[model samples]
Target: MHLFRGPGFVAGFSDRADGSLDFSDRTPEEAGRLWAGLPAVAGLGLPPPRFAHQVHSTTLLRVGADAPAGRQGQADALMTSVPAMPIGVFTADCLPVLVVAGEAVMAVHAGWKGTRQDITGRSIAALAEATGVSPARMQVFMGPCIGSCCLELGEEVVEEFRATDPGSLACFARGARWHLDLRGLNVIQCLERGVARAAIRHVNDCTKCLSDRYFSYRQMRGRHGTQFSFIARLPEEGAPSSGAA
Candidate 1:
């Protein structure tokens, strides 16, 4: 679904219906063949989308016009100001966040570890510094992810977040087990970095809860394929923003 559409950019999250966008367990040749058929990437008139090895770390890669098309490296986020060059992240239950500021855009993969490391905040800072755009002027769009209702975490994991970001304690709940709000914590990180609350939008669908529509790692028990979430700044002469697909 299209998460954000402006005069200069378009950002959206893909679903199972769009086909798995990551290689995962598939052979390289099979993956490449399947990627070629993905409807989301076909007919966009943009260059091949850029992705990263997503190690669940806070590493952020910057993509320029000259950057190569395939896997860029190990990173949880990708940012660029180059028009028509799409950047994205693959995720199953982890949050896929898209940020836009004028001509600059970022696609972030915020799994629990990345969130604990404040990847969202770091991306905002990096993009703002690179584009000279204030964090307040940036817009954030979050895609499907595991929600508190289904994201039961162990006490050690809960303590890890609590130790690093005490303020994140508010994002946890005590049920039969500790449930964490991955989306809410990222929103808090964005707000802490000066992004206006009104500027943040998200798809409320829980990946685990909506397994039929989205890929959910937890629901699939480590056998899930990932869907892609992407954004690109269109060239001046490119087509106008078309919301969703």
Candidate 2:
């Protein structure tokens, strides 16, 4: 029931039924059904969405009805102006980004690598350029992620974030060993992209800290179920008026 949206579309990531994605094993169909049920869970009653390969880079793909199936391309973000196309991205600890302006929308997976590479900024720029959404009007929602508390990193990675954003130190603490604040850094990056501060909504839930209500790559150590978050442009006139829970 944790959902976030912008001016045009809605999206959310799911925790396991018990409110945790900390599972050792699960079938692909099991995962599929869980995602397919999102809209109903939200009260929209729509089916699941199409997803991209998510290479953790800054490549943003413009998706429409014609987009190919099974990994739209080697990209970390996907955008669409077409209503109901439902672009989506999957992740355990990576950031799930949903951006919207009127009817044009985008979904992105911004991992530390993607954040360092400026994926959020790049994808937002692409959305504006392709759909003519003024930055002043665009809104971005940064979903749950591995906060700095649990996202420990080596000096090399620490230096990468610091270099990309010197101000990000506020989010990182000198952990017992390394430093990290993947989410804070991403929020700084979002503000840098010209998105209005008032337009950005952040979900404070941390996947790693609130393990029972989220999926955490760090907590699971690579053997975890993945959850998908998605967004799709709704028709301006005839779209269903019923809101999802």
Candidate 3:
């Protein structure tokens, strides 16, 4: 469903009810057919959303109007300023973040590894630099993912985060196991990059907790389906094109 809609863009986060949108396991031809049948893509009359082969890295790819309809390359984030073109990412429990700045939009996939690399912050910075827009002017939307209540991590993982940003330690809680607040840490990263608190929105739903409504890789023992989250700059006649190419 659409989580945020503005005069020049729209962002959506899909659920299990919307059917599996993950095409990684399928052949290219099969994946293309499945993508074409999605109600979200067909109903909106949009081309197949541009995405990438997410390897949990901080790599970000830029999509132009002439970009292909499917997988663009190996990256964890896709950013675009082309109106009517959609960019997206797929996730089962990992976080999906959608960003909008003026006429530019981006879709990011942030797992623990990506978060450790501050992918969200880097994406915001890249977008700001590319579009000539301040990070404060960007709007961020976070989609469903494993929450702290169920995201148990190893001590090594905690140490990894500590190495990246010592202040991020606040996002972890000690108990029977180390519980990491993945979403909270990303929010902190965004705030550090100048994204306003009031400009951020999150679904707050835990994929593991609501397995019936969403997909959860951990809850499903590493075998789980995935959902798609996307954002697009609409082709409005009089919309202001303030962001960079």
Candidate 4:
């Protein structure tokens, strides 16, 4: 249970360790459900997290009790200002981001497809619409994912990135295939779109490299589980005990 506590909320991604916090299961969606039901996460003051049926598109949904009711939504990103309503993103090699700003919290999923669609930038825009929190004032966490060291891309993906985010060209190294730096590309997009450099923090762990600590789709040839990353406003009434337990 890796964690990040911003000013008004607790946010983090579940690790791959075998225990109550282990969010991985047979499928990514199932893993999301399992982690949301964990006792420790419940103590953070929320019902089961609302997860997106990610399709690697640019769709971002604003969710809560008032907005949606089930785990059957289809979007790559979700934002909410409602307390006790947890929002999450499931990922294996893809990037999972949790953003906190004022009272608005968001969880985003971004693989090469979603990244090309600029989902992270849209998430910031969505939060800005709800509050005055700009990128500089927001606290953002980029969870563990496939890093530059292992994200080799084919020509099709390379051209897609080039067509969508021209700046993405800066995040690649040539080899047998293009060794792309997805994390760097997203951080670049955020900074270019207005996010302060210091406000963004990356977990910096490579899923493919850390085989014992995380599931990696590329490492496993597309057959692997996933990790859930979430963020929400901490319940002010009875906050759970938190620390290096």
* Best by the lDDT measure: 3
Where does the lowest 10-residue lDDT sum fall in candidate 1?
A: 236-245
Against the true structure, candidate 1 reaches a TM-score of: 0.90
Better of 2 and 3 by lDDT: 3
User: How many clashing pairs in candidate 2?
Assistant: 3
RMSD of each: 3.7, 4.3, 2.8, 4.6
Residue 55 alpha-carbon offset, candidate 3, angstroms: 0.5
TM-scores for every predicted model:
0.90, 0.83, 0.92, 0.86
Tens-digit per-residue lDDT, 11-87, candidate 4? 87776773333232235466556655675575664555667778898888878556543464788988887876678
What are the Cα lDDT values of the candidates? Answer: 0.85, 0.70, 0.87, 0.77
Higher-lDDT candidate among 2 and 4?
4
Candidate 3 lDDT tens digits, 1-245: 54577777778998987788887667657766776786666665566678899999999899987886777889999999887778899998899999998878999999988998999999999999999999999999999999999999999999988887899899999999999899999999999999999999999999999999998999999766898899988756485643433
Off by over 4 Å in 1: 23-36, 236-245
Better of 1 and 4 by TM-score: 1
Order of candidate numbers by lDDT, starting with the best: 3, 1, 4, 2
Question: Model 2, stretches more than 4 Å misplaced?
Answer: 5-8, 18-35, 39-48, 162-171, 236-245
Model 1 over residues 168-189: C-alpha lDDT tens digits?
9999999889999999999999
Q: What are the clashing pairs of model 1?
A: none
Candidate 1 C-alpha error for residue 148, in Å: 0.8
Give the lowest summed-lDDT range of ten residues in model 3: 236-245
Better of 2 and 4 by TM-score: 4
